[model samples]
Target: MRPFAYERAATAEDALRRHAAGDGAVAYLGGGTNLVDLMRLGVAMPARLVDVARLPYDRIEHRADGGLVIGAAVRNSDLAADLGVRADHPLLSQALLSGASGQIRNQATVGGNLLQRTRCPYFQDISKACNKRDPGSGCPAIEGDHENLAILDHSPECVATHPSDMAVALAALDARVRVRQPDGEDVVPLERLYRSPGDDPSRDTTLAPGDLITGVEVPAPLRMPARYRKVRERASFAFALVSVAAALDVSGGSVRDCRIALGGVAPRPWRAHRAEDALRGRPATPGSFRAAAEAELAAADPLPGNAYKVPLAVNLVAAVLTDLAGEAS
Candidate 1:
């Protein structure tokens, strides 16, 4: 690993000032889970790391409106083990437990998970040609081992999938990120925080050079039946092949309201707006769930190697929604 300086900031202001002094070559360290791995691989070579893991943002607050304000530094294990989170937002808790291992979860933070880079092999191997690693260098994954790559919102420049299970649940919950910007604080919707791999694959998120995520604000719980289901090659420590985070409200055998987001099929956690639109007033049946899944996946454009992801994602979405509908009933 390359030599670098590290400093733990006592407050958000101190972290921001230190980063600003580094002139855009500094990275904020939350848990050092992802950043350290990238640094060792030489994929990321930040001149300095401003440690923000100890910044005064490690608490999870339950609001009066039945929502949550989760601190950026809250460990994944803590968040998943919180009784309030398990009762109110079971899907989020499920997602947290489904990721990594017990030890890593204990060390990983909410902010670090959201900002984790893609696990694309090409991006990790500095010897390979990866557009995300080097703009315009080329994306060999397009014609290489892309069995786990993206099927939606991908461009010629890149086909990498975002690897955060937590973000997918947050997207379904309509959570917003609280950021400490260079000038002031700002709150951005979770979906808006990520960027699809367009012409510029180098940039993963919409955060500015000096922006720091302090916390996430989840809206009031819908109290509907929700579920998070993931399909992977193995049982543990494996990223999702396809996953669904869904909530359904059924009344009189009809879908009253719903929220759905898909992971492992897109550059970002894909909000299933088309599926939600199709199911809002439809009968809560297997056929309706299948149709809704199909509607959302109609725009999928997968590469030859990963074309099977399309049908896999479709079936997964349908099955998850069907189960959620059953719970609602």
Candidate 2:
């Protein structure tokens, strides 16, 4: 790793000030799981490191509205094991548990997990051309080793997919992200945080350079059956080839409401709005689930080698919705 100045920040303001004092390439250190890997691989070359893990953003609090306010510094394992989270937002807890191994979960923070970069091989290799790493350098993943890349909402400049399981759940649950900015604080829906790689693959999120995520706010419990299912090459410590986070509220013999989000298929956690629209008020059956899944997959623009992901995602979505519907019934 390159030699860089390091400082421990006692507060969010301190961290922001320290980052502003450093050269433009300063990075906030939290858990140091993904950032350290990037530094070691020479994919990231920050001039200074501001340790924000010590900041007072580690608490998980209950909101008066029967929701949750999860601090950004809270560790992944803690969030997954929290009794309140497990009891209310079980899908969120399940998504966290389905991610990295025990050791990684213990060190990964909620904010860091949401802001982590893509796991694309090309982007990780400094020698290769990756638009996300070095803009205008071109993307080699478009024609090489793209079987695991995106199949929806992808651009020619980038085909990488976001690798956060927690973000996928947040998108499905309609969570909001709280950020601390230099001017003031702002809260935005989690689904709007990520941007498509349209013309600027270098940017993964809409957050400004100096902005810091403070916490995530989850609305009141759905009080419905929900599930997070992932399909990968192996059962443990593997990235998802296709994953689905779904919540269903059924009334009588029909679907009253539902939310669905897909991962491992886009540059961001794809909120299946089209599928949700199709499923709501529809009969809770395999046929209905398949139709909704098809409606969402129809917009997919699969690449040459990743056409398989289209069918995989469709099947996974259908299966997950069917299972959740059965549980609700």
Candidate 3:
């Protein structure tokens, strides 16, 4: 790993002030699960690191208004175990549990997971041409083994999947990321936080240079019967091939409201808005789930090797819907 300067920020403002001093070459150090690994691999060579681990983990706080406030520094393990989060936002907890090993989870932070980089093989190796890794460089994955890459929101310049299970659930829950900037702080809708890789793959997140995620506010009491269904090559410590985060509000065996998000198939945690629209007011049955899944995958643009992901995404969404319906019973 390249030698880099490090500092511990006592407050959010201090972190920003120190970070701006280094300009874009500085990176906020969260749990150091992904970032540290990248630094060792020479994929990320940030000249300086601002330690945000000591700041504060506001935690998953249940509000009287039936919302959830999750602090940025909260550990993944802690977020998964929060009683209110576990009960109200089951999908979020489930997604967290479906991620990396316990050791990694114990250190990974909420904000860091949301901001994790893509897992594209080529992008990780500095030797290969990856637009996401370096601008003006080509993307080799387009002609390579893109089976595990992306099937949604992919551009010719880049086709890498955003590998965060927590992000998928957050997208489904319509959670907002609270970010603090030089002027002030504001909440950005989770869906808007990520951008599709269209020519400029280097810009992964929507957060400006100096912006730091403070915490995430989820307007919860999550329309009940939510689950995160993940499909992978193995049962443990592996990324999903096609994962689905689904929440359903069922009344008398019928869907009153629904929200669905897909991961491992896109550049970001994708909100299947059309599918949710189709499922609302419809019976929470396999037929309706199938139809909704169909509606969502219709616009999916799959590459040559990733066409299988289209069907896998559809099936996983339907299965999760079935699971949610069963739980409602």
Candidate 4:
């Protein structure tokens, strides 16, 4: 086993200091949901751990701007049960409920969920050839059991999808992520936080290694009707096969505005740009939904085993829009 140093921070600033002094080789400790497992598997060999567990950023607050303010360390379980958040943003509550079990939810943090590694088996096994784990190593999933992997926004180097159900909901709401870099703290729009894996799959996020997510700010809801739909192999304990989050407001039987995002079939929580573009200022009908889903999926690049996801996701998008349109509430 590789040896490492551990330092606990008294404040948020101290955590940043420990991370920067190590030249970005430091890992910020969250609820240890994914990180602890990676360390045991030898997938991550950080030289130091900056434990930010003691920081006072674990509370979930509602902003006066009519938005949700989730601290970086807020537990998944707590976030899911917050009355205000659930009543206003059902998409978020639904995502959290669909994630891991109750025990795991109590231990996972929103900040860590945003930064969790891919669920690709090859990437977790060091002996296997995985581009995401070792930059130059060829991707084994290119010819392996990629049925459970990504089908959209994939490049030659990688097809691993981001694995957070909550993230998909957040993306649809156009949330903002706060990061405490080695130098200072700043906020980044959620849509730009993840990068597509082109030739380099080893780099997973835009967060420089030492940078830690400090909090997430969900903007005020557009007052448009919104909902989330998730389908999985199991009802209670599984990741989505094809999930969708949407916010729509129809004016005079036409779509005046909409926000769409997809999960479980993309490199990131895919903001359906094609669908979003196709949806705005159009008639709210099943035909238009089909056209929109097809337009967005046109750019998807699927692997040999996961091609079925394309049609599955397309159908799901159409169904979700139809259900949401029929709802009177």
Candidate 5:
């Protein structure tokens, strides 16, 4: 790792100020789970580190509207174990538990997890040409080792996929990301926080350079059965090949409302809006689930090696919705 100046900020304002003053490649240190690993791999070369781990953004507050506001600094494990979260947003809890091992979950913060970088191998190898790591550079993953890459909404410039299980749940729950900008604070929908690679793969999120993520606000609880299912190469400590986070509200043998978001298949959390539209007011049957999943996946443009993901996603979505529907009954 390169030598860098390190400072701990007691407040968000101080952290932003320090970040703004830094000459080059300034990064906020949260759990040091992702950023430190990137530094070690020479993929990230920040000139200065501002430790935001000590900031007072570690609480989980219940809102009067029956929602919850999760502080950015709250550890992943703590968030998953929170009684309110497990009871109200079981999907989020399940997604967190399905992610990295206990050690990593203990160190990874909610904000950090949302902002974590892609696990693309090419992006991590400094010697290789990765458009996400270096703008204008060619993306080798387009033709090499792309089986685990994106299958939807990927640009020619980048095929990498976001690797956050928690973000997938947030997307399904229609959460808002709270950020502290230099001029003022802003609340952005979690879905809007991420951007497709498009022509500039160097940028991972829509957040401005100095914007600090403060917390996330989930709207009123679904009050419906939900599930987060992941399929990976191993039982644990592995990234998802395809994952689904789904919530369903069924009434009288029909679907009243539903939300589905996919991971390991897109640059951002792939909110299955098309599927939701198809499933709403429809019979909660295996056939209906399959059609909805297909409707959402019809837009997928998978590479030759990853075409299997389409069927995998289809089956997973159907199974999760069917299981949830059965439980609802």
Candidate 6:
């Protein structure tokens, strides 16, 4: 609970200006669901809070091509309940609903959801050595309680998993983030938006100092069967041990096209390109599904505590794709 100045911005320009005026010590407020929690834990201490929740980015626009432009300020509950979202991109809607509780979802915005930090105990404690919290200090999670940490695309410096269920679906859908940056506006692919911990575990995203996510542009609907399945320690409110967001298209008992993205297994939403490549043109069978999933997970390098995530992810992927294949059949 550090003392900080707060200002509400009426426009994106205003928000950016306010952030700049803070001299790089500002955080954009969007619902305050995740950011506030971190602040209370003393993990984040911003000198100023630019309230971007009031910005004019609160609408979900339906494109003629069956795509959608979802505003950053749109609440998770609203996005999940949108009729167009339910009918067209059911996976996205399903992922949103599967996340936090109804009350939290009511206040959590799309942008905030994407920006939520990991729930890693070491990272949150502040007393522990967390590379993400203090670069080069060390990542105790690597040898500490890492049962829920990453198994894919992880480095020795960091094994923390991205906690956004919505992001996994967006990666599968090939969504792009529209950002208002210091230079100008740019549309960045969802996959490119995040970078692996690599050598710099402190930086979660590729966004520069003054980049603001304006909205997410999901490309045209798949018009095919899709599913989002999550496995957690509990029934609800718990983060996924492993989650799969998958869409499959089948014709003549063969896979036509498919997209897959994995969460809770990597530093970012891991697009299962290897799996997709293996499944395309293959028979739409459980065996094929398993093989594709295995191909994608072959590169997994898991720690002792989190090694179970590898098999969990493999089975979850096969099961989800199987369910979607059944629906298509």
| Reference-based lDDT, each prediction | 0.93, 0.94, 0.90, 0.86, 0.95, 0.93
lDDT of 5: 0.95
Worst 10 residues of 3 by lDDT: 57-66
Looking at candidate 2, the ten consecutive residues that score lowest on lDDT are 57-66
How do the residues 1-329 of candidate 5 rate in per-residue lDDT, one tens digit apiece? 99999999988999999999996589999998999999999998999999998899999998887699999999999999999899889999999999999999999999999999999999999999999998888999989989999999999999999999999999999999999999989999999999999999888899999799999999988999999999999998899999999999999999999999999999999899999999999999999999999999999999998999999999999999999999999
* Most lDDT-accurate candidate: 5
| Candidate 4 residue-wise lDDT, 1-329, digit = tens | 47889899888878777887887567988889899889889898888988876588898878887798799889999999999888888889988888989998999989888988998889889889888888888888988878889988778888898888999999999999999876688899897899889888888788776677889999886687778888788877877777898888777888888888999987789999889999889899989988999999998778778888899888998888878777723
Count steric clashes of candidate 5: 0
Off by over 4 Å in 2: none
Q: What ranges in model 1 sit over 4 Å off?
A: none
lDDT of 1 by residue, 1-329 (tens): 88888998888989989999997779999888889999999999998899999998999999998799999999999999999999998999998999998988999999999999999999999999999998989999998999999999999999999999999999999999999987899999999999987899999999988789999999998799999999999988999988999999999999999999999988899999999999999999989999999998999998999999889988998898889887888
lDDT of 3 by residue, 193-261 (tens): 999889899988898997999899898477677888899989889998999988888898889988899
* TM-scores of the candidates in the order shown: 0.99, 0.99, 0.97, 0.96, 0.99, 0.99
Off by over 4 Å in 5: none
Model 2 C-alpha lDDT versus the unseen true structure: 0.94
Error of 2 at 216 (Å): 0.4
The lDDT of model 1 is: 0.93
